[model samples]
Target: MQKKAGPFFYVFLALFVFFVMFPFLWVLLSSIKPLGELFGDKAFDWFTSHPTLKSYVSVFVNYPFLRYLWNSTVVATVTTVYTVFVAAFAAYAIARLEFKGKTVILGLVLAVSMFPQIATISPIYMFVKKFGLTNSYLGLIIPYTTFALPLSIWLLVTFFRKIPFDLEEAAKMDGATPMQTYFKIIFPLAVPGVFTTSILVFIAAWNEFLFALTINTAEKYKTVPVGIAMFQGQYTIPWGEISAATVIVTIPLVIMVLLFQRRIVSGLTSGSVKE
Candidate 1:
């Protein structure tokens, strides 16, 4: 039997939800408000006296926001696909095959993930510049993949390790080749983990700011974050427009998480205990 939550539990949960959601609520409010009301004395009011979609419309009309969205979509989608594909193979090898220096390799992957992006940015920028990839999709995609791989690999290794070795043995007994066994039997069973990793990597790539800003300086290649950050004026900042753009950028991620949340939860928990 399970115990029911008391008043204190409900209070704490409500408070925690509010604490996590207040920033988004504030941004949403700001997006709907007119510039004067957004910046003026009634800025913190819970409801705006006059809510308008002018800011949202201006985002599309005055700027190349659609192009930025498209750029972000392409970069993030490609990065997630490439990172998960490579991580899948690397993780399968690490989890199933016996190899020397396996521990060292895993440790190195963790170390690379923990390495400060700021510390490595200069060299990455130089490398991209040397390859003449700057101001291009590949420029951002490469760095995003580098940062995204370690976590994806780690999560996938956990999932792959949880798959029964007997399955592989059975496939081999049936005269299936190694590639056939992996693609047919092992990979399908690990789909939940793969989906989870792809979502995380995609979100990271979409929201990445520093590498996008540094590597893709041209207006045509700028992503959502870089484009949003570049929103400015000679006399004042366009807070309403900025907020509107932020809301627009965040909606897709929210919808994705909501739709696939069950898979994400199951994927994360499935590998926690050995069968």
Candidate 2:
């Protein structure tokens, strides 16, 4: 007979899922509730009572939300693209090429990734200001790429190492140059790793609050994280509006993860198995 999960295992799994989903469920339900229902003494009742999209409407109508969205999208897309491209080449070299001090360079890359970003923010700010990049997409994109590159390269390197070397040898035998081989052969095979890195870098850049708040002073240049944080005023916190904005910002990421769930799982499993 087939064995069933034990009671404790099922109970633990149920609790884990509930814990993971509770915050998202709360934000979603709160986003649809009216201000009165959200703030009323019987606030819990808001979940089942009249739901409305007034808060979502207010967010766009009362704020430069579209500008924030656009800035975030542009910065995130640029950062993700550049990071993935640079990291792919760097990882390919590290995985497939041999040179002196390669191990030392890889160790340094890993060490740099471990350093807290806050520690270098001041220096980064000064460098960006010197380059007159503040409040510009370049300001955010450069730093995002810098921070995301190390991890992306490392992760891609791990996956690239898992690929059989014979494929590359076969491609070279067909008169394919290294660049052509990378584009035509290796890149296609590294799709899972690339997608995994892109998702991670996009999410990191999207939710980045500290650097976005620090570097982008103009309201028009702000990202979603900074915009959402400043959505409230000194006099009051618009919980409904904040919650609505949170839901909006979160939905895209949730959808991306859901759509690429299989790829992410496969990528993670591949990394684990190879390691």
TM-score of each: 0.91, 0.90
RMSD, one per candidate, in order: 2.3, 2.5
**Model 2 poorest 10 in a row by lDDT:** 266-275
| Per-residue lDDT of 57 in model 2 | 95
lDDT of 1 by residue, 57-115 (tens): 99999989999999999999999999999999999989888899888988888788888
Candidate achieving the largest TM-score:
1
With a 3 Å backbone cut-off (N, CA, C), the pairs that clash in candidate 1 are none
What is candidate 2's CA lDDT for residue 265? Answer: 68
- Candidate 1 positional error at 71, Å: 0.8
Task: After the best TM-score superposition of candidate 2, give how far the Cα of residue 163 lies from its true spot, in angstroms.
Answer: 1.0
- Give residue 85's error in model 1 in angstroms: 1.1
